[model samples]
Each structure stands twice: as structure tokens, then as C-alpha cells.
Target: MTTQAADAAGSDKLDSGVLKVAGVVVLGAIMSILDITVVSVALPTFQRDFNATYATVAWTMTAYTLALATVIPITGWAADRFGTKRLYLLSLTLFVGGSVLCSVAWDIGPLIVFRALQGLGGGMLMPLGMTIMTRAAGPDRVGRVMAVLGVPMLLGPIGGPILGGWLIEAAGWHWIFLINLPIGVIAFVLSLRILPKDKPQPSESFDFLGMLLLSPGLALFLYGVSSVPGEGTVAAGKVLIPALIGLALLVSFVLHALRKEHALIDLGLFKNRNLTISTTTLSLFTVAFMGAMLLLPSYFLQVRGETTLHAGLLIAPQGLGAMLTMPMAGRLTDRIGPGKLVLPGIVLIALGMSAFTQVTADSSYVLLLGALFVSGLGMGMTMMPIMSAALASLTHQQVARGSTMMNIIQQTAGSIGTAVMSVILTNQVLNSPEATAYSAVTQGQVPASQVAPAVLDQGQSSLADAFGHTYTIAVVLLALCLIPAFFLPRKRIEKAPDATDEALPVAVGMH
Candidate 1:
């Protein structure tokens, strides 16, 4: 909608300007989520194009994700120091530039380097955008604004793989990154026009020491988490050394923050009762969501013996499920409360996962689709309410720190979740590939000479059973997550009767 039309609809509802800003803000979320989702389907192309091992090629995604995670802590200060719009524009420029560089990267080394640059840029987008959009929305209307922004955050991951898979087949893997260029350009331009025109705050320092402590700590942590045992993409230095250094730096930063009169993140926020409990839940919830989401596709392709395209198609339903359900859940969070929405969402996700717990070598396609939809439905409902409740207790000033902290923990939880599940799946599948391999090998009965190199390289299982066992392991992880969902509270937040609805537009992003 045009800015004028948007203003007309909700004069005091939202800044007429924010409808436009929402597009600009959620671009970061879209970019970050899509990077991982879009590329999973293109691993085969990466293998052929860059001549990479399975472990190394996976880093293209892992490196970006870790780099993104590592840099997330810095965004609040970055925005406070640099001015959100300027930094945001710079981030978009970097992401677009990195995408172009990645498209032309001739070697795997260059590609990985280029992807890291992309991650560095992308790592800031979601949190910063969230800080901006959320601050703009203010507490009174956070529910409404989040409901709007949630569209892209939820859809991007669910859709990224499908969009990337289709585009890769139709255009090429290069198009995946290339596609971001137009989106970035539009967002950058709109940000200049629509984002809150705010001044940088006083006494800004770059916090070089904070960077020193945090980045490597996060990178190391991610490296350890991504390492999948025998399938082994674990970086020894990347996983261990940086992790040690990063941890030391982080610890030192905490000490520094404690000693200093002013620090980037006030360690004092942790003292808040509501903030503490809610943040913990956010972290755990993310671990459950991201860990399981990552496994779904691998289960389909590696264990189920489906082609990449078919696997992607089935996975799309999960996204679809999330897309349809989140809006209602967000509203429900406003109406009932976070507890009701979050707990049921978790339960539904667990139930959907439970459905998969029954998945076997002979499970029907119908059963798989139904379970994915249910799982997606559960997750869709969960994300917004949990986020809303976590931030709800914090004032606007507290939110800037609290939100970033929440993002850090939630993002970290996902990484850890995936790591935990991968360890389990990899070990179990590697050990049990025999039966599944036997079935596919006997059936394809294709001679080695006839099999494609890519097909042959996957190993052991005659493809079919390998995939079946993979799904089996994923279901186990799903079951592990179910244990936690059972304990979440059932209270829902109803809209406060005394809360004023007819005020001037809630001042979002000003915080």
C-alpha cells in the first residue's frame, strides 16, 4: 500500500510510515533465514561447482550462520553508535556485495570467505531490524507490529528452501544469492525514506574489546555445534581454540561490564525476574525449533530416498503450516497471554513430531505430510507469543538490551539444538545404515558403473534405507524436544481491558 493509504487506515494505529518500514525491517530477517534454507538444496551443485567435500560445502552455510550468530551481540551498540538507518544501509550494501562476490567465487575457499562476509552483514539484520521496528511500535502496540513483521520472519525460512530449490533448478545456484540484490536495493532505498530519522546517541565507543571477546567465542561455539562426529565437518581450531578464546573474551567482557560505569550490555538486566525466565524459555524454544527444522529436509533426502526436488516439495508444507498459523497465535497471545499460545504451540509441535515418531521404513507419504503440517502448525503458534512474553516485561530501554540478549540466546539455542540432534542422527545412522543400505542396493541393483557419482558418493544404504534411517533419527530428536514442551505453562494473555486503544500512534523504534 502507498504511504498515504497506509496512514489513512490507521492514523493513530501505526505511523503511516511504518507499513513501509516493516518491509525494510523484515528484509534482514528474510535475508538471514533464506541464506541457510535456500542453499541446502544446492549442496549438490556446490559439490560439482566447487569440488568440495560434503563437510566443507556444509561450511558455506555453517560459517555464515556462526558468523551471523557471533556478530549479533554487537548490533545494539552498532546501531546506538552508528545510527540505525546508516548502519542498516551499510549492512544491505555488504550483503548485496557479498552475494555478488559469492556468485562469481571460483574456488571453495573464496566462496567460504565470501559467505562469511555475507554472514557478517546478515548477522546484524534480524536483530537490528527487530530493535528498530519493535522500538518504533512501542510496548502498547508491540503485539500489532510483531504480528506484521512476523510474516517475513516465519515465511522466509519456510519458503527459502523452496524458492532456492526452484530457482537453482530453473536458473542456477548463483541465482540464489543473486536474487537478494534487487530485494536489498529496494530495501536500502526504502530504509532511507521510511526508517525513523534518528540521531546517533552520545558518547559512542566501538567496544573493540567487546568484539574481541564475543566474536570468536560465538564462532568457536558454533564450530563445535556444527561438527557432526563421523560425518565430521568439525573444525578443530574453529571449534576448540576460538571457542576457548571467545569464552575468555566473553568472560572478560562481563567482568569489564561489571567494573565499568557504562557498558554495552548492562549485566544488570539478568537480575530482572520476568526477563530471566522468559529469556530462558526463548533460548530453549529456539533450540527445539531450529534443531528439528534443520533435520526435516536431511531426513527426507538422505534417509527417505527422495530426490532433492521432491524432498523440498514435502518440506514446503511445513512452512505453509507455519505461515497460516502464526498470525492467529500472535493475536491469541494478545488476547489470552503468552503461556496459552506458547504451551499449546509447543504441544502441537510435539504432537506433530510424535506423529513422526511412528514413521518407519514403510510409512505412507500421506502420514509424512500430515505430520509435517502439524509440526509446522505447532511451531507457527509458538514463535511470536514466546518472543512477545519475553520482551513484554522489559521497558523500552530494557528491551533494546533484553531483545538482543533474547535473540542471542534463541539463535544460540537453535545452533546447539542442531548440533545435539546432528550428533545423535549421525552416530545412529552411521551405525545402522546396513539394513537400509541393503534394501536400496538390492533394489536399484544398478551396477557401480551405472550409478551417478553423486549417488554413489552418498554411501552405504542403497539410498532408500539410508534415508529411512535418517528420518528415524530425526523423529528421535523430535521426541527429545517433546519432553520440555510438556512442562510449559498454559496461561494465555488476554488484552487488558484498561489498556488504551485510541492513543496517538504507538511510538515504535524510538526506544
Candidate 2:
């Protein structure tokens, strides 16, 4: 044990034991992250199988996201209250059980309910995983470990649609949920055997008041935001009423949190300037980047008449580009500071996305792919470094709470970005003279080539214009991210003196 501790303390490289724990965390993360995108591609399949409208089927996604938002505010407290190892196992159990139930759901309503149940578990996985890894890696190596954990974040979007599309086409929609059974079981078992036993501090009182306010507030606000794309206007009653109520509750929570030491999310963490700037930067980057990412597959399917699988394949270059830069950026972040890497990354992203603002119906595939690859390269440098900068400066005790806050900001920002962009594109398409033909192409009701040539030409042009205009907004948002990135710490972060090196047991019996 002394030898193991000495080895861990002496080395900067990740030893085998830490890598094993990372593997466990990554597996759980894959299951949680992949579920979101996997289910998205299966939505149309749900509509067909359950004989439901698109709006009704969309609740499957909305319900899952709402459950995620609702459960997230409580996770930091829960991890400390319940041992992380035990809670992690329970989450895996719930998620897998929900997956099983979803596979057998008989109606759209049942599926939506089951998906929310799944999300209740999924919401905790990433943040919990972050806490575990942060502890295991210690503050000095957080940048590298965070980069390792970022694998699924990059892979899920690229792989989910392809996997989901293939499953839906070859087997059935049920397999999409059923797929989690094997992965979940393996993750559960590995977690039990590999992870360090939890050291829970249950002394802090649970913040029930904060929970009541923030959880419902986030769910309601996001619910209203999610409604915008479908309703086509934020002024609609359904959008306005719930959003206003949610805003009121959120404001109340903020005021209430300010007075309390142990609020649900610990709003006081914003006192850390690094965390504040990083949070702002993450919010803007996710809104612009993720929102734009969602639109790419849609573009290929609608304008280019590609299969879901093909669209997913086409988007792979961006992920591949990210893959190229993530590891190098991680190492550099540990040696330097995030601000240096992040500024250049944002610039590259803006440059890559600039091409999309000029997209035409027959834009060169090579050119588009090159642009996406460049954007991916920028992503590799940007996302996790910001995360590392935020958490590295926090005390070991505060890592869980800090990660929770970051996750909440990310979820809310991403939802808003998706909703806002969708509305813009939807409006642009609807207002076009070729609205009917373009709508048919987008909805998969008709192929662009099959339409009258003149109409196809004009309609495709109109559709491209809408997408181009939307990309312009996304680029502007990316530029806004640069303002915050410029402020991130540029020097190597020092470890907090209190961050003791408690090396994890290499195996179940070794300690």
C-alpha cells in the first residue's frame, strides 16, 4: 500500500489503477450520453410504431430532458449523502431497468414515462463520474483525466445516429433501448469491482426548499424552451405561461440560495472567478456549437437526400478532427493554462463554421467536410480545458458541487440553443416562396430530385438560405464565447494543499 501511494504521488502519468477506474467511468458515461442521441433518431420510428403525431412523440425526448434537469440539482447532495459507489450502482440499476421497460412499452405515453425514469438515473451518471475521476486523478492531473473522460462526449453524436438508424432499419426500435442492457450490466459489474469504496459525508442537511424551487424551475423553463421549435413562436401561451412561472421560481431560488450556506447548487461557487468565466464560456460555446451540430444531420437528410446512417457518417469528420487535438490539448492545459488554448480553439471553430453561412444546395462536399473537421479540431481544444480550469482551482471537497453547477449550466444552455436555432430555421423555411416543397423535403415526405426541376432548384436554394442564415447566428454566438475564454487562467494551476493524495486500490483485494 505504501509503495502504491508513493508511486502515485511520484508520477504524473496515469497508472493502471487510475486508468481502470476511468474505464469504468467512461463505460457508464457511454451508456448515459449515447442514450440521448440514440433515442433522438428513433423518434420517427416511435411515431410510426405507436401511431402518434410528431409533437406527441417528441415528448419522449422532452420527458427525458425534463427528468435530467429535475434530478441534476439534487445529485451533488445525494452523492455526499449516499456513498458515491452505492449511488452509482443504483443509478446503473435504474437506468437499465428503465431501458428494459422502455423496450416493452405499449404506447407513446408509456415510452415517454419510461424514458423520464431512465433520465432520472442518467442525470447523475456524468456528474458522479466527474467527481470520482477528479478525486482519483487529484488536482494536478485533472486536465488530462478530464480529456480522457471526454471520449463519449465526442463519440455519442457521431455514433448514436448511425447505430440507432441501423437498429431501427434492421431489427426494430425496441433494440435501441434493449442495447443498454449489455453495456449497463458490464458497467455495473466493473464499477462494483474497480471503484474505490465511497467516503460519504452525510452531515450536511438536505436542502429541500432549494430542491423544490430549482428543480421545478429548471424543468418548467426548459419545457417552455423545448416547446418553441414545435410552436414556431415564443409568444404562444404554452411557451409564455410556463416560462414566466419558471423564471419566477428560478429568481426565487437564486435569492433564497444567497442567504443559505448549503443551497441545492451552492450558488456561492460563482465567487471563484475562474469558474464564473469558464461557466460563461461553456454556456456560449455549447449554445452555438451543439445547436449547429444538431442541424448537420438534418441538412444531409433533407437537402442531400441521404439516409440517417449516411448523415451520421458525414458528420464523423468533425469528431475525427476533435480526436486529433483533444489529447495534445489536455497535456498542454496541465502545463500551461486553458486561456491560451481556448482562445485559438474558438477562432478555429468560427473559421470552420463561417463556410456554412455561405452554404448552397450543391455546396462542395469536400469543402463542407473540411470545414467540419476544422470545427472539430477547435472543439478538441476548447470544451474539456474550460472544464478543467473551472474544477482544478476548486478544493477536493467542492469538486462535486462545482461539477454539478457546470452540468446544469450546460444542459440549460444546450436546450436554449437548440430551441432558438430551430425556431429561426423553421421560420426561414416557412416564409419562403418554396415553403411546401422545402417542407416536404425536410420532412422526408418527398425527395428533392423527384420534385419539378425548377421548383427543386428554387426550393433547395431557399432551404440552403435558411440554414445559412441560421449558421450566421451560430457564428455570432461562438464569437461571444471568445470574450470569456480570453479571461481564463493562463498559468499552470497549483494543487490545493488540502488535496491529499489517497491512491485508489489497484484491485478489489489489494488494499
Which candidate leads in TM-score? 2
TM-scores, each model vs. reference? 0.84, 0.97
Give the per-residue lDDT digits (tens) of candidate 1, residues 1-511: 3344334334435565556667678776677677777877777789888876767888888878887877788877877777777878888888889999998888888888999899888877777776676666545455556767677766666677678778988998899989888888887777777776666666456667666766667776666666644244455554666556656766877898787655766678777654565666666666656766767776666556666667778877776788788877766655556666666677777777665555554467788888888878877777776677655555554555666777777777887777766665555554554543433453344455655555544453333344444445555554554454444434543222332332123233332
Q: Residue-pair clashes per candidate, as listed?
A: 23, 0
Cα-based lDDT for every prediction? 0.67, 0.88
TM-score of 2: 0.97
After superposition, candidate 1 runs with Cα above 4 Å error: 1-15, 203-206, 229-242, 433-511
**Residue 411, model 2, lDDT:** 96
